[model samples]
Target: MNIKKIMHVENLTHFYGNQIGCKGINFDLYKGEILGIVGESGSGKSTLLKCLSGEISPSAGKINISLDQGGVKDFLSLPEQEKRQLMRSMWGIVHQNPRDGLNLRISAGGNIAERLLNVSEKNYSFLRNTGKYWMEKTEMDSDRIDEFPLSFSGGMQQRLQISKILSSNPQIVFMDEPTGGLDVSVQAKILDTIKSIVRDINVTMIIVTHDLAVVRFLTDKLLVMKDGIVVETGLTDRVLDDPQHSYTQLLTSSILQV
Candidate 1:
């Protein structure tokens, strides 16, 4: 079966003045596929992600997205309002820090409701029910819907953030180190939850992280980056088991030694 392509990225490059952020990045993301970008600090994985997710503009590149309204469009060429609408409706971003993705001042359900509201959901009962449903889906406590995010533990806060993003039923999700800064057990649980949720929703995802284990567990395809370039790209298992590039080989070996 041929999977439909959801995004096409070509020669994506970004710079911080004279410094390279990411250069000549290219990839195709398919519907419901989870693609992982892995590298050490300053390898340009995060920079590439920010550029793709519209958090930052690229210095040069083309990002074409297959829209739900039945057409392909250059994401970078869209007006700011159109980009914001796309972000609000079809795209969801999960930040490395849960606090960065969530509103700490609002109740947990209110956070979910806010996203639904952006999508033009106006029924109060439906919004509350949907929020509770998503909380349970993310393994969060539905009863805590009224509680502030600050009152939750780090892991719970992350779960709540996931619930809020997924509640709107977005087509694509950009995850920046979603499991970062968590304990081993918490990481494992969050990863499992994310895997299950993605499967259930059939949402496409691009995740940037340093952990090889994360890519192994959650991603179907992988990109290995170094010095602002993609050094290798392939099926996750094949790349991990038999890395070709010197940087990729060293990266896989280092993880084995850990």
Candidate 2:
């Protein structure tokens, strides 16, 4: 893939009062690339997502995003309404739990169609057609489109959550622990499903995960975090196969040991 920075962060810092979550993080996410973040808990992985998404503004630094309009803007400096609009159509965040991402009361298709409702200058027919197209693309059977999220298995629910976000066609997708809490076999399937979707659609992804094995399966590049800081980052193969930073080496070693 031709490499260019889709999102750039420089001098990035996040603080909760006196305690820092992540400090001076500089990185770039390329188009059609899967960037993995691997770190132990409390390593500021989730905090970075919050900062980037504008859910909680960063204490300091610049986040520049290339807009579809052929312009760039500081995502951190945007007005509240503008940021909210950006999130509704341009960006997506998938939580660790499928249930957390989906509405239990709604059918799978309703959950997938929520994005269209948020920006519905279009008619009802457009939304319905779009929903069914995405459902089929995500490997969801047509009959199950009307089923409640509660009725699906964990893996199925996760696929539905994926379908929900992909239907919006976000420029970037940030996933927090995409395979957490599932057994090894189920986790692998989830990872494979996600990889297939991203490859098919060519969306950039930033995945924060504790599981290095999943990272290997899903990401093209990597960033290793330690104590609210980025210790290292590079091509996934380079970092895992031959890490330079001590902390990164330690992380890869532990994963290899397992």
- Estimate every model's Cα lDDT from 0 to 1: 0.93, 0.85
**For candidate 2, what's the RMSD?**
1.7
Residue 194 displacement in candidate 2 (angstroms): 1.2
TM-score for candidate 1, please give it.
Answer: 0.98
Q: For residues 41-97, could you state the per-residue lDDT of candidate 1 as single tens digits?
A: 999999999899888999999999998796999999889998898788689899989
lDDT string, candidate 2, 1-258, tens digits: 566677999988999999989899889877888888889999999988889888898889999998878677888888899988877778888888999888999988788888878777367677777778887776777678788999988877887888888888898998988778778787887777787888888999999999888888889999899999988889999998999999888887875552
Candidate whose TM-score is highest: 1
The window of 10 residues in a row where model 1 has the poorest summed lDDT is 249-258
